[model samples]
Target: MNTFERSGKHLAIQSWQKLNSKLFSGFTTREGGNSTMAFHSMNMGFHVNDDPDKVRKNRKLFSEDIGFPVENWIGSKQVHAENIVKVSKEDRGSGSLDFDTAIPDTDGLYTSDENILLTSLYADCVPLYFYAPNDNLIGLAHAGWKGTVAKIGPAMINIWQEKESVDVKSILAAIGPSIGHCCYEVDDRVINEVKVALDGDTVDTVYKKNAAGNYQLNLKKLNEILLLRAGVLPENIIVSDQCTSCQNDVFFSHRKDKGKTGRMMSYIGRKGD
Candidate 1:
């Protein structure tokens, strides 16, 4: 499946073509914004030391481009944990214009509330998108190595099943652009954690040891494995081949920029009819 289809400055989910047209889901690129310096142009994250006003302006531009209201956007203070929060109308605009008002320590946000956009920031971290069309639920998660080892993908699916009464089998999952295995080399600490998080066979499939003994971990494939284990259909999961670090011109990369980079925003929601 064509996971992400680039249209100008954003990458829309081509796999969602058969779904409701009003279900807006995509990730922003590092183009077409007003931020300066390290943030360059399209930085959508307010916590990355970019000018707040510039970040706000960028948000407005992105929201307008995606056909979603800027006031309807909600975000979180991502802590790289598996903490998924169920959002509602009351949570709208939480972290839209500022970072202080974001949901505390939340890396994933899911909602059945229409017209409320759920967003999370990312640089090299994987952006996991979930949709349960059967229940009109949408979810967005920031899955860095910490969150991935914590199995945040499966955690989101569990939340949907328990809180939203969503059937896991009906969930559609997408793993967005991040630092791919070609550039993501990790030491034993991360490798051990990944080994602990995933099954033995799956670990082999998602990780490989290099000559220096460092391991290359594929976060996207690991997340896909997590989704499959959580009962999502194999055919319903789409993994993007785009690597944020590899394509820094189109996206931001935390590692590639030595931790002083901006962030791209990943959002999913349904507009009001």
Candidate 2:
């Protein structure tokens, strides 16, 4: 996968087929938009306490570049849960509908219909994109600590299977950029939780003890395992080795920003009508 910039505010590692298509999807960066110091520029998350006007403008830039109306994006409130919601064209503008009764607790969203954009917000959390290239069904998920521990990848795959009747093995997965283990220091509590959730196999491969004995967990690697375990082919998985905390210039790192920062978005959708 090779990286490309869209609307100058978003960055993406393009898949082989996506390089020349109207089906636009990618991860956003904190650049090329109107925002203050903490939020910096190009911040797309309104929930991060960035100015509402700036967030709107940034989102508008993204929407225009992608050739979709800004209001058509289906976003989650992102409570770090593993709830996978199956959305359709009819459900368009429902979750983020009216801005008040928006979705409150979901980390994964799936849709087989075209025209409705599926998005997952992230600062450092791993963004997983799913596409059944044959059926053309697509989905996206925000897999943080809680979402990973809850096995959100498998949950999303199961929902897609049931809802769209697509085979799990037919899914192609792309794990977007996130906090690498070199910088994602975790305490014993997170280690224990991840170990238990992964049944010990994920411990040695994804976690390492530093000189100070604190653990560093690689959420990207762990999520790759999750994708494989969920029946996605190993060759079908594309991982962005770029680290958010490592490259603060192109990404928003929650740890690096001390929780006072904006977010980037990983989005995927079929070509609109």
Candidate 3:
């Protein structure tokens, strides 16, 4: 029932209470960093035209606060596709220091390796987290409209089953903060894509037409439904109520900021003993 627990400048996943003590997962806020202007503070994304040094500093602050080293963080180019990559210790620090060095054309990263942090930046898109305690595996995915329609949730599930032989029902999934349906109105183009991606009942359950005739699409619920269809248990899923556009003080919103904004980082990893 609980979404995320706020500590200092970040929000830790409350469901982590049921997991191993070495497991760490959370989403960053827009506060407490060195970036200025549109990036302001805590802009952990280097591709947003923010100063690279400031982005690095912000990343360092977050890593130090979370007890994870910046040097161990792994990133991705995030083309909003369903490309999921399995990371290892050898892939550590990829995209951590810069965007060019990150995994190319990947939106989802999964690994059972300890001390390798999986990270992705977000403004209004969904950040999907998956953990299979039995397998000691963790994964993170960036699900924008394109990625969600591409079925990235199911992609992660498929990867775990194919690569790690994980039972889909045992995976714990969390949908992170993003623009909610209340403020996210989509035109026919996006609505049509969503309608095609989901079933009839699912489309009705996740989308509602407003007075202005535009549809309010619930990205979080859509992703949750996708996870459920992928066999993740209903009780094992946590959906955050926080909307980035509505709570601009605590988070960044690409739409609210008119596409000019910083990005929050969603990260998960297991610490080495």
Candidate 4:
């Protein structure tokens, strides 16, 4: 992954092809902006205790750095559900001022319109960006433990194929930074849920029981397998090795911060043709 400091935030790229003169995608950190302690610096999420004005300013800097209008970007309320909304130009600036009507309890957003930017909130959860070059469609989803267990990753692919005529095999996927196995200690319940969610081919490799009897799960690998099962080419998917808990200085980790932490934004949009 390549990192760059922008708007006092750290941005990472899973693949160079994900970047473009028009398409913009990045993961935000706790630097930059004007929020005070805890949510200090560039905190883009408004639901947190961070002041709304400060979040707005931080968002302004974030939007400008990515060359998009601050008021034009749309963010989901992120209910951790499997619902994926299809965005349009009419949805611009929906959640920037109000989360009620804007977000509306969705975990994923997709769009073929260039004017619409699809964004999802993430603190420690994995941010999955989907790009179908053949169909000129883009999607972004937030996958926490529950959502992952529900296999929302594959569901998103199914939606694209059914709604947008997307060719799953030609799509490219990128998994952003999140809590890794080294820090994501799980109990028997989560391990069982994961094993049940993943297929037989991936069950053995996705989780490992340590000497202490605790299970360490690799969410990145799990999602990679999900994408492959959803028909995406193995070589077309790239996962970031950056662990949020391991590298707290550059990214936000809910585990490290004990639930109070800033968020990283993962976005994908089609270029205007």
Candidate 5:
């Protein structure tokens, strides 16, 4: 699977784009918007304490360029849990312009409906995108360590299967830019939760214990494994190698910036109504 490439101000998921022309799916890069200070430019997250006006402006730029209006987009509170929401046309404007109106306590969202974009904010945490062309379904997830251990990857698959009767084999998944194992070292507490998510099975391929007595956790690999465990075919899953902390020049990293930073957004939707 090809990793994301630079497209305009954002890094578009070209591999997925090649898979489906009308499927608008990609993650934003921290360029091409009019913001300053820590945000610099292209900051799309409203709850990151950046000026709301600038965030809106940045979103509008992305909307115009991506051909999806901000009005047709829906965002969420992203509580870093495994909670996933099934979106509808009625939920279009939630969290688009303001965080207060965003879907409450949701870390993942999916929809079979057309023309509505589902979005989630991220810095170093993994960004997950799902598409099932047979049913014309698309989904997005924010998988920080908490959400990953909570099995948010499987949570999305479960919802689509239960609510929409989607076949896991038909679900194509993409893991977007995140903090790679090289930069994401965690203490015992986080690894313990990851162990639980892995059903008490520790795979050495997922992480390596550092000399600091912590572990270098591969979040993207963790998500890929979760999707595979949830029944998505191994060939159906793709992952991006871009690391937020390593490529801080192209993205905002919460850890690289010591927690005072901006965020990028991962979005997916149909091209038109």
Candidate 6:
């Protein structure tokens, strides 16, 4: 079953939204915007060669559509690494308008602060949304292969546990849409890294040997395995089965578009209606 439901402009994580009325968590699609060609429309990443003005307008339209003001949004300068930054209201508007002001070298964001919308741009990368209701903590991590092998999801759980002095079992994680195993084949190099990252843990469910001798890796499941290893309860996790590559009309896939395509945004924030 799909964890996210379409709500006009974006896919809302209904389960998360239901857990906390003030919590706002969802992902944007490659639609309802002003961008053109290569980007086409709803391109949220300013560094993706899309028109700056158009990207800005797209941000404005999305923020208005979601009812989270443009000024309350924060973005990251994602380098495909596992750096997760904890933000607050004081850090609002950092990357809302341009890339230069975005939080540097960060692929994930967390906040106990309200009114600060944390966002990360994606094109087939796994968007990991985390929430610890005991502390009202919400977070997002951009998990591409690199970030996944680096264990960014577990890293976020560890940080939040430390941040709130709470048990990791209390954390709830949602694995959003990304390139699925059916569409993602990797060479021995990536497979080797996955093996090393798991530290000799079982990977039977994470990947498989395809007919071509290459491996079809499941990034979303890989992340879930790591989260389970990190102590997040099995029932506390939900994975989105929507493959960006398969659903090209609803999402923009880097692999599907041959590296030249628009980006979707994954966001989670704490704000009241």
Of the candidates shown, which would achieve the greatest lDDT relative to the real structure?
3
TM-score of every candidate: 0.97, 0.92, 0.97, 0.92, 0.97, 0.97
RMSD score of candidate 5 (Å)? 1.1
lDDT of 3 at 238: 92
Model 1 Cα lDDT, one tens digit per residue, 1-273: 447998778998866844788888889999999999899899998888899999999999888887788889999999999998898999999999899999999999998889999999999999999998888889999999999989999999988898778888899999998999998999999988888887645466699999988998898888898889889999889989999999999999988988998999998988777
Query: For candidate 4, lDDT tens digit of each residue in 1-273?
Result: 423224335564535344454666667777777887777777778787777888888888877777677667788888776888888888888787555556688888888788666777777888888887667787888899888878778988999889778888888788888889888888998887887877434476678898889988888878888888889898778787778899887666789999897776776554475
Off by over 4 Å in 4: 1-8, 12-20, 200-202, 271-273
Preferred candidate (lDDT higher): 3 or 5: 3
| Model 2 poorest ten-residue lDDT run | 94-103
lDDT of 2: 0.79
Error of 6 at 58 (Å): 0.7
RMSD of each: 1.2, 2.1, 1.1, 2.3, 1.1, 1.1
lDDT of each: 0.89, 0.79, 0.91, 0.77, 0.90, 0.90
The number of clashing residue pairs in each candidate reads 0, 0, 0, 0, 0, 0
Q: Which digits, one per residue and each the tens of the lDDT, describe model 5 over residues 99-153?
A: 9999999999998788899999999999999998888889998999999988888
TM-score of 3: 0.97
Model 2 Cα lDDT, one tens digit per residue, 121-212: 88899898888877777888889988898899888787777777888777878888899999998899888888877777645778899988
In Å, residue 269's CA in model 2 sits off its true spot by: 1.4
Error of 5 at 144 (Å): 0.5
Q: Which ten residues in a row have the lowest lDDT in candidate 4?
A: 1-10
Candidate 6 has a TM-score of 0.97
Single out the weakest 10-residue window by summed lDDT for candidate 3: 196-205
Stretches > 4 Å off in candidate 5: none
